[model samples]
Target chain A: MAVLERSYKRYAGALSPEWSRFLIIPRHAFRDVFRSKLFTGLYALSFMAPLVFAILIYLRHNTEALAIMKLSVVNVLPIDATFFLTFVEIQGWVGFFLALLVGPQQVARDLTNNGLPLYLCRPFSRSEYVVGKMSIVILLLSSITWVPGLILFGLQSYLEGWSWFSQNIPIASAIFLGSLVWILLLALLTQTISAWVKWRLAASAGLIGLFFIPSVFAAILNQMLATRWGNLLSLGSLIRSVWAGLFGTFVQQAGQVQRMRGGVIVETAMVEPPLWASWLILFLICALCLWLLSRKVKAYEVVK
Target chain B: MTLDAPATSSHLNDSPGVITLDNLSVTFGGRPILKSLNGDLRGRAIGLLGPNGAGKTTLIHTLLGFHQPSAGTARILGSDIRGEANQIKSLIGYMPERDSFISKMSCIHFVRFMAELSGLPPGAALERAHEALFFVGLGEARYRNVDTFSLGMKQLAKLAQAIVHGPRLIFLDEPTNGLDPPARSRMIKMIREIRDSGQANIVLSSHLLRDVEECCEEIVILKDGRLVVYCNLEEERKANKKFLMLETRGDLKSFVEGIGSLGCECAMTSDHRLKIILQDGTEIRDLYKLAAASQVQIRRLTYKRDSLEDIFLKAMENGSN
Candidate 1:
């Protein structure tokens, strides 16, 4: 009987990060980003918004021609650059909301059930986990910002004719690259703030403050100080100024060929204080946020 | 079903006979949870049972290399906690008490993912996942999305992920917890199968003694970060029931006077009927011949086995206060 008792017994669980731990975040984020109704809706809006603006521009341009010629229907319309700029501006604005949604949930979900402890029991350390999360945020931002932006850029170029594509490719790419930097900074800042705080809502709100509040304060300081650098210090002003700088450069050089009817486009030329400075500021912000994030990382066993 | 070849590994028998503590302790949030707990642990299945606020999770965390102990050492599986966490952890399969699986993935995918993380090759990982899920008896349901799974299914999925890697040891924090009776039994059977295998060892901790009693060969009890009861179910089961039941072919009454001298007490009901409460060192033949030398009718006799509950309570009584 004693031997039988001993024979029937068993013991078993050891969790290590060396195995399936990384799969948890990536797989969940993939499913959440690709399969959820929320992401689908957001993704559709992101892609379709550009087309909608293009269509509206086409209708506006050709409507008068169709009316004057008394044609029953119009098959073609010119692409308007104004609609494209508006799309770019709206893209930056919408990114803020996207950052708000993505940042908080990542940390808050872990905190809710003491999930950190269970996961810590695995082979991964807190740093690796944080890195994994940051990787997901970067991927999410890339999908939203660059992917759709590139498609829209291509679509617009095709509609504008091969002449415009050949002439404006360099200028268009530089401006797009600048926009990507902006998106990268926005995503990193928001995600870092999210990791630093426990509550999802509070983290989201905190990210908003981290992203915009300092810029808002800087704007007010610019008014009082009346210095270009003061305005440059504000993140919003920096983004606006940098993008405007890139656009202004495009206008001065590329517009020479496009031949703008309005007074010589001077705003693009005004974005002066060197392109490297804007990049440096963005780099600084990203580094700061990551440092703060490293501080807030709590090591414990996280489940799930 | 025994190895004629003696086990060669020093890990299996040379040590782990007694758990030795060298001023091991842990603190959390400016408060000490385990205050320099020092002791030796030797037994089969150990249950680190404690109340909710007693820092059971914290201690397990330290053991799993999650938390650095504020002071001292937690030696398990042949090395101090931190020094051999990798070696020790490679041998362990952990089942957490809650539903922590990736919610949207299919069960098979989730288990397979963990298996790969445990260093299994892709083909072997998927195969093991299927076998593990089948072992846990979740077969066809393995392909179902975990988000849609019921809580119990999710729990089982977590368990499946833990065992898919074929770890050498396992730390189950309430495996049967929150499970229905049937689900609990199914889980118990799976644990038993894993335990009986010679490939691994297990140190499962749970507050539920019933579950501990179900499959554990030994139980090491803990309370308030201190050792409370180390109930060896195998030893305890042998200690109770039919105390000193004797059979003889001669006069057992003639042996009545010699029973106490043999270091055991006796109960004489009739001339030939004898019941002896054998002491710690009493020979089986001493009683047999005592009756055989004279004349006593040989009858049926055996010592009854003790239930785990009874032994557990006694151990608990002895350990506490």
Candidate 2:
């Protein structure tokens, strides 16, 4: 019917495919997410790390610029596994902050304003709803995390030649797969917190507390119990272990000297937790978050 | 605009009813909210009526696939709610009793989002969203955030979203709740127009008997999770006809006897008032002729029937039995 008629009319038009309907959630959610100037600024700021990394990679290959500065190749930071690992770590934190800002409000607003019935009453399932909300964080995080990291990897591969690229193929995989693990973990955790805590500020705080509070407790447990097993409580430590394992630098990073005493270097030789254990812990944490999300994301509560 | 188009699909099977409950039951924590509700509701506009705590909303929720049926299942538009819930959801729209809307979203945008979720393409969803907002008399305010709307406007926005996708069936729970008279009338008028448009079937659940009486062709009343009564209002109204109340000036006793002799049941409520149930083929002119013969001045004569309130009360009493 014409808009001027101002009456109910049957829409006999073609419908979108059923599988693509869930995309509508993220489409609208992205509109709301980008509306925040603070978030937009932070998101734009997230690309600075990759841009700096890209320039550094370019400088490594640019001998003329280096000669003009009268600096040798060894004087600058080496673009090794450590370099890419540090880049992944920095982007991971950026992803975390963005998730904290965007993820908490994804499901909380719907729950707080009684909007789930409007969604769940349509041709949308709870699983689809969760996936849609999770995609908001996933897409935003992916753009900053793996997407730019891969572009940087490709740039280095093109500049450094096939010999270095062939020798360090795992770094490329580590950049993509490691970033994915972190992004998925952050997305799931924030969404689970959003589903449980209907208040946005509380959900954001809950996400921060989930990461920081446990690390503090883990530190205390490690000091008192003298066991590295306590590190399992710390998500940050687990993720670092997993990332180090992914980059094949676990041995080098884990055996660093702790201190120097009495004019002599004191090497602690601290053995890191097994890589499998860290993977298991992260998987279990993600699983628990999924369970909590499934339990809380519903159209109505049954009060008995 | 005049609505003359036939419904695009006749997929709603009449024999199975628009909504068919097959021993449907729902329980929360061990207590049953809907206890084996079994019936087929087939009407252009079906009214679900009950007092508070009567499982009206629970039944709707069950049919919408929000609550799992503890015993049996229901079907909407020939699809099993359990097996084809998403398909059924695509065909149906729900306006919940309580306030439900996305905050900080414009009215048109909210409706458009809902339509998109129902599988409408973006452009069509937006177009329909605007038409729906305008149809609900929120055309001027479509761009305003939903959180800023008054209760009445919010109700209209809820309706706009519910109908934006051109659903085959619509479930409206408390559609006129907490509205002033004019807004309530407007809402009722919209409901009637939608029902008459024949583009969608309507299932209206409300406690107000007048609202149901005004809009519903058939009613299903529940009490204490039990089916209290299911009757066609049109048939009930027809059957309740030929009943009248009268006030007369003289010879009430003879007038009563004369009314009985003419095959009408008459009762004297007071010295000057009478309640008469006219038999079939009985005419009011016959009563007037009898009243003149009896020298009784028929001062005030009024037609009376069992109203929806009376029907509801009788159902309540019978349901208690």
Candidate 3:
């Protein structure tokens, strides 16, 4: 009897648990995203607003530094609900652009080259794949938006003492909750667009347009219909209304700021839609996004 | 010669099945792609062979839980595909019939990512990724971006990814789709080694009968979403009756009748050629004696074992029936 040669070696080790598999996607995605200089540069730039806010908090506590800069005590911005709301608004846009920059590179490349089968053939479910992609944007967006916003909130809490912190505890919650809603929305919308569009640049542009074009359409609908009902079409307004509701004290201040800027009547001039309506719209948009993702994210396209 | 035995020595009846389809049917749009497939495959290396529209790819996808069966169920590695899909997927590797890879990453990174997704720790995944790349003869090009690989290299990289996780079963769809003859031989040799090693049960789907015959132990033939033939290739070869091709000079009809009278099936294939299917007791020595006594010269004589092509043709005939 002759023996056969064996060239393949058997694996004797144990496998990792199934739950740990979902992290694999985001781990590789993070590496891919950070490999780009443009993404790294923009990611670093996104922190500029938060750093300014942090310094503003530092300066607000230092009356001596204000005097050195020849700025009056009255000129110093107070660390209040409106202040954090404005901070969130700025960081929200930063998160938006960051998501636009980062999100397309995540899913669009996977779909274009038919990499989903390689992924789906593994232990990953469709929802897990979506969550894995979503987690990358959420991590990136959170770093720029809520993570720093809460740090600034904590810094202000430390500087202003317990009395101010207790009286303004809602602002801290608002900062966290508001940034989460914003980033989650951005992440979902961007992933949705990236899932549908195969080209990375087109997906990125689609994300930007998902935000900007709606506002333009809302303005057009508002002008033609002569009703604030079209304000519902503006994602910015809907999200801001949710933010205003979260902050509680910023509704009046938001209206005043809009009056000061006096740009589009549909954007700031319109009062936040009924609070429930804003929440409902956000929920609907998120549901629509999830629906789009479930449709497009698949290993094989069913011809029927 | 020992290849006549079942490929795997394990007690297949006692061991868990590699795949079990219970009336598994899949329909796309309105037409059914896989119509009520039912079988239990226990072979260490199973070949899925079929013509166009034979539902080979659909069956692979349904086994991977990429497609939901219209009516029945499929259990892989003894796990139900409907509910235990992820678990089933964790146990098997799939090399789809297309170019599926993230083009931006190096070959190692891509394979490592696949291993990690298949439930290996990152460190172990990286180590195994390198080992797999080397195993598939892609060690030098492991650092090269996947898009830069040649067609053959890409196929090898796909194989590397499929085996990186040490899966219990691996479904390789058209593993040697586009390759030169040498590359195809290399791939077939690697596949034979994998099958011989018994590291993983392989389900190879291909239109090329030679590729299947080279590596697979058991064969399944399908036509029009239905099972045509499923049997061990060794048994099929053994059960086939012995046949001979002969070139005889002078009096071919009388020679054929002389063999026919001895309970053999004989026919003239051409003016000078005779096709003879010998019965159990008949032997080539008897034919030599008969030709000598009949004054017919046996110019050329060759014994022929049934090939996979013969089996495939028989299956196609059966499928038509």
Q: Estimate each model's TM-score.
A: 0.67, 0.90, 0.86
Best-to-worst TM-score order:
2, 3, 1
lDDT by residue (tens digit), candidate 2, A139-215: 99999998999899889999989998999888999999999999999999999989889899999999999999999
Best by lDDT: 2
Q: Candidate 1's fnat?
A: 0.11
Compose the digit string of candidate 1's lDDT tens values, residues B1-321. 011222223224465632345566787666777666655455445556655655666666677777778887766666667687666665567777666665445888878766665656566767778877777767779888877887778778878877777766677788887889899888888777777665555666777767887777776555566555555676666665427555555555457777767778888666555676777767667666755655555576777566656655665576565
lDDT of 2 at B264: 84
Quote model 1's TM-score.
Answer: 0.67
Error of 3 at A261 (Å): 27
**What is the TM-score of chain A, computed separately for every candidate?**
0.68, 0.92, 0.88
Interface RMSD score of candidate 1: 8.6
Model 2's DockQ score: 0.63
- Deviation of model 3 at B59, angstroms: 0.5
Cα deviation at A66, candidate 3, in Å, is: 2.9
Clashes of each: 41, 0, 0
Task: Please report how far candidate 3 places residue A93 from its true position, in Å.
Answer: 0.3
